[model samples]
Target: MAADLYPSSPAPSAASQTRFQKLRKRLHKDRALLLLALPGILYFLIYKYLPMFGLVIAFNDYSPFQGFFGSEWVGLGQFRKIFSDTEVLRVIWNTLFISFLQIVFAFPIPIVLALMLNAVRNQLYKRIIQTVVYLPHFLSWVVVIGICVLFLKSEGLINEILKSIGLPAIPFLTDPAYFKPLIVGQVIWKETGWGTIIFLAALAGVNPNLYEAAVMDGANRWRQTWHITLPSIRSTIIILLILRLGSVLDSGFEQIWLMLNPFNKDTGNVLDTFVYFKGIEQSDYSFATAVGLFKGVVGLILVMGANYLAKRFGEEGVY
Candidate 1:
């Protein structure tokens, strides 16, 4: 039995080797494409992967003069300090609140807007609307914040309207209660149009025949949309949802920074803004790095878990 089993496993092993050689040859033939991808590969390596090495700073008493290698290692001291800081808890609360609001309120607006636009038969009107909506996305966060400041200020257009209607001027930007809503509104206004592009593309890919079949079954426009349109785009929705979950911690840095004031600081402070304050302003680089690194790791876990759950539900999620 041993003799028979040991006799020439060589053929199968040789076949595997031959297959490997063929793959290598095929890759060699695709050298031009590989070369084309080299710049992007190098960019990620240098900018993304290389910077990851700096995560060591999170465990150290990082000093610019001492640099990474010579810095004193403090291990979990930074994390302990972060947890003990009262403002840190507030920052975490603000970040999660803003992110949650965005996901809950702003996420679906794009999909609904896309569907509405898709239903519009008039091409000129559709294009005009699309252009108007997407324009805000291209505007710099500074410009968007400036516009918000103008519109949401006590004497702004909205307050002016309130005055005309014999109502008191509302402090939209300065009030802590209104800060979360303002952030949500800003995100919806600036990003909803841009977010629609993907949904629109997904909608375009949906087979018209499915809608026709639904119609033949005596389905109304709304019924067709429910049965055919949504079902067809379910995978796209799942994919985008997974992608969004990946960045759940990243509530806009620039926009929040620009819009934030001391009066609303309690509600407006997020992880990103906190990092700027701690790392750049206070020069506590190590502590800030630890906080940021912790957030990143948690975000990764969330995305991966979400993607896995989506796959388990038989949906196409971001792998």
Candidate 2:
């Protein structure tokens, strides 16, 4: 009578059933963590991933009047423009040179700052310094450039002080020679402290006993830093360097744009500025998007190559 009252449902396939159960259990276990991450995941999906669909316009002779799908398909014609343009090669060269400067100069500032901060024995002073250094990062590029202009301009504070000492007021802003250096300097100032956060966090995880052992072996502070401290953070540094190479194209668009003028355009006109002039100013969206797409592809390749090299060198890269 009981058997007749109910029929058994068919069992799901063993592999699929097991996988589902495991996934469900894992989700349940990490429910709170997933919940916390939900907002960020949603944000990226909405803003970053969804908008990637618009990249299709890069393949077209896109016009506002024609709309997205209605735009004429130009194939690689837009990208062809990027390679054929003589001025673009100069802009590319400028971009590459600036990126090289940033990597060579700006990339190390954070690591150095982290080392300095890590060495500081006084917690109070370290906190104060950290707070001070981090303040600039919160300021927008406009604000930072405004502040820089206030100090670096002809009649600005620095020139005034220089003039007071019988030195000539140098054209730091106007001179093409100074433009690249100034851009790199501004990046170092703004991002050095913020970048140190990752290194500092890594440093905190290092074993304290290593320092004690180094001390027992008569290792001085410099020796300890070079031998123990730097070695311990070697992976962290390498990982960061690899990641830096990935986005080397993004050499502060807003700051450079703000600083650029007719006087410094010869040296200052980078790919970013070129894209802006073509896309926004000249309303050649397809051309601008093609240039941007090239940049993105190059960045992706750099990231992959760097990651492969990192793994070959036995350091965990940003996989």
Candidate 3:
């Protein structure tokens, strides 16, 4: 009975041998292209995938003095501490609030801008307007924050104008109420033009014949846009949205960190900033790692969920 239970492995069929040979021949034919791709593959393997091994530190009471392997294993202790801490909960809420605002308010602006640009009658004006909007994207966050401070400060231009009008100066920087709006505004101003690039490309690929057909059928401008333009770029929008959801937890670390102050900390504090304070500033490596790991898990879940919804709606999604 025991002997009967042990089965012999099947030999490779002639068809399988041919298939393997075909694959080998194809690889050899594309060797040059494969060589060109090697650097990118190696970059991800070295810089991205290789560092994932350090995630184990989240489960350990890691100490730089003891090093990675020498650190004491604490299992879920770090995660437990994260959940039990009230401050961490508040930080998580702030992170989610800011992220939600960005996704809702900032995400659609680029699409609208692209549609408007596509409808422009003159190429010269379109190019000039595109240049003006795209210029802000190249500016560093430090420069942007500096400009904001220069204009939005109590004694600055905005307040000075308000003062001239016998109006009170609004607290743009220090108030918690204004923090989320400021962050969203900065993101929109800096990225909206750059974000429109993909949508514009998608729009360009849309057949002009479709518009002509629609016009012949007595369709109006808005109807043509709704029926032809939006549907053509729907797949591109879905793919980008899925990609966006994958990084939902990453709420602009440099920008938020630069803008964050003690007075606005309640609204400005997020997982990235919290991790910086705990991991780099306070040197609580394991605890901070746990928080980062949690954020990554949540982001992964969001991406998967968004992709699933997109597919359910019969749309092409990022796979």
Score every model by TM-score: 0.84, 0.82, 0.83
Candidates sorted by lDDT, descending order? Answer: 3, 2, 1
**Residue 39 shift from truth in candidate 1, angstroms:** 6.8
lDDT of 2 at 85: 94
lDDT of each: 0.88, 0.88, 0.89
lDDT of 2 at 287: 89
Error of 1 at 193 (Å): 1.6
Q: Per-residue lDDT tens digits of candidate 2, residues 185-280?
A: 999989998999999998998899999999999999999999988988889888878877877787778888999998999899888888899999
Q: Candidate 2 — which residues are off by over 4 angstroms?
A: 1-50
Ranking by TM-score: 1, 3, 2
What is the lDDT for 200 in model 1?
96
TM-score quality measure for candidate 3: 0.83
- Write down the RMSD of candidate 3 (Cα, Å): 7.3
Query: Tens digits of per-residue lDDT for model 1 on 245-278?
Result: 7788899999889888899888899999999998
Displacement of the residue 165 alpha carbon in candidate 1, Å: 2.8
Residue pair clashes in candidate 1? none
